[model samples]
Target: MAEEEAVKLFGTWRSPFSRRVEIALKLKGVDFKYYEEDLTNKSHLLLKYNPVHKKIPVLVHNEKPIVESLVILEYIDETWKEGFPILPKDPCQRSHARFWARFLDEKCLPAIEEACLRSVDREKAVEEACELLKLLENELKDNKFFGGETIGLVDIVASVISCWLKAFQQVAGVELLTKEKLPKLCEWSDEFVSHAVIKGCLPPSDKLLASLRAHFETVASKELCT
Candidate 1:
């Protein structure tokens, strides 16, 4: 790709979905311009590009818009399949990887959201979240990454869990990824965040914590009032 090849990314820094595409692009050595969208007052370009979702993390390659983080991820992998392949090539292995990725996206992510953002039953929410984390820890015990040795499809989807888990821990005043209880999971998190691409894509820890704290306070106050 030429330096002048038009590749633009519309995303929000705070969104994990957006961060996934950003990290994938960086890892694949794709040169692109990033436009941070204020979701409240979304830009005309964003709406025009992704008319369906009006969401961030829309990748424009050669002026073609690709919406949805997972879709964009697969697009990136296919477009730049030669270098830094995010999905495995083997059919059976790839299917298994996709299954785990979908599991995290569907089951694990919703559980975390309910625990941290919506559920009135805090204890039950925590228990549900812990169960999900326990499952993840068990999965990682025998593999260095979700793809065994290298970070792949499942790892990317699972990355959302780690980011939210950290922020939720701070806001919920709980420790789930403990060194003693989930040593491997904690280690996997450490390794994932330490990766150059992920490290660069993540928002500053202080900023993320402050944002999460503010959100939690607002939600808790609303619950108390009702």
Candidate 2:
């Protein structure tokens, strides 16, 4: 690829969705220009690149924009067709991978957010989130990662669980990710964050905790005033 043909990824560092794309690009040995988007004040480039969603993590490849993290990841895999493969070659396995990824995003993520944000009935929300976590634990049954021994698409998609959720819990003063409570998930978290590429992608824990704390303060203040 020529210098001008290089990939350009518009993202915010704290966003798991954005980080997913970043890690996949690094894993695939694809060089990209990372343009960190100011999510509160979204850049014109981001709007121009992904006018529809106007979301961070829009990937600009050869001036063509790809929105949505999963779509961008798939595009990267297909376009490069080299280095490590994100999705499996086997159709059945690939489908299963997609299924788990969807489950995490659709079911688990919402439950987690509810558990953290719902000050009233938060215990109930936490219980629901735990059940979802158990379902996820079952998904991880004997594998080191959701996608078997190696970290693949499902693992990449669930990076939030491994990297940021604990910090969010700390800031929110919630207890969704206790080691004794969710042993398997806890074990996976430790392993995932420690992986070479993943470690590089994760923002430092203290820095992330500070960010989450400030966010929660704003949320709490709003609730109190309202």
Candidate 3:
């Protein structure tokens, strides 16, 4: 790929989904220039490229825009088939990887956030999140990483658990992932954050804590006043 080919990524600084694509590109040795979009004031280019969802973490390669982080990850893997393939080679394992990735994004992350926020249905939220997390814990029991020995697509998608979840847990003043309760999951989180490519982009705990605390307070005030 020529320098002028200009792989451009539109994303926010703290977004794990964006980081997923970014890390995938780096792992594949693809050079990309990043545009940090202010989510408060989304860019016209982002709107033009990803009109339907109008979301950040859009990947523009060779003047083509790919929306949704998971889809973008697959695109990156297939396009640059040179190093560290994200998905497994076997058909069955590939499907399993995709399934778990979707499960984390669509199910586990939401439940975990809801449990942390405890905004409504607190008990149900906590139970649901714990159940999902237990499944993940079992998967990680015999493996070093979600992908066995190294970080893969599922590991990339699960990155939020290591960084954002810790920040959110503190801000929400909740105790969901304790070292004793979820030791394996906690261990995986620590390992993930300590990994080289992931460590660089992991958000500062203090920064996220402040931001999330302010956001929760604002939301809480709105709820109380209403």
Model 3 TM-score, 2 decimals: 0.94
Give the RMSD in angstroms, all C-alphas superposed, for model 2: 1.4
Q: What is the per-residue lDDT of model 2 for residues 1-114, given as tens digits with 9 covering 90 to 100?
A: 784357899998888999999999889888888998888899889999888888888988888899988888888878888778899999999889888888988999999999
Query: On residues 137-217, what C-alpha lDDT tens digit does candidate 3 reach at each position?
Result: 888867878888888889999988888888887877676677877888898888888888788777777877888888889
Give me the runs in candidate 3 sitting further than 4 Å from their true place: 1-5
Residue 77 lDDT in candidate 3: 88
Q: Choose the strongest candidate by lDDT.
A: 2
lDDT score of residue 207 within candidate 2: 83
TM-score of each: 0.92, 0.96, 0.94
Separate clash counts for every candidate: 0, 0, 0
- Against the reference, the lDDT scores of all candidates come to 0.82, 0.87, 0.86
What digit string (tens of lDDT, one per residue) describes model 1 on residues 1-226?
6732688999988888888988888888888999999988999999999999788889999889999888898999989877898988998987877777777888888887777776567678868877887887787767789877888877787777667678877777766667877788888888888887888888887898888898888888998899
Best by TM-score: 2
State residue 45's C-alpha deviation in candidate 1, in Å: 0.5
Candidate 3 lDDT: 0.86
Sort every candidate by lDDT, greatest first: 2, 3, 1
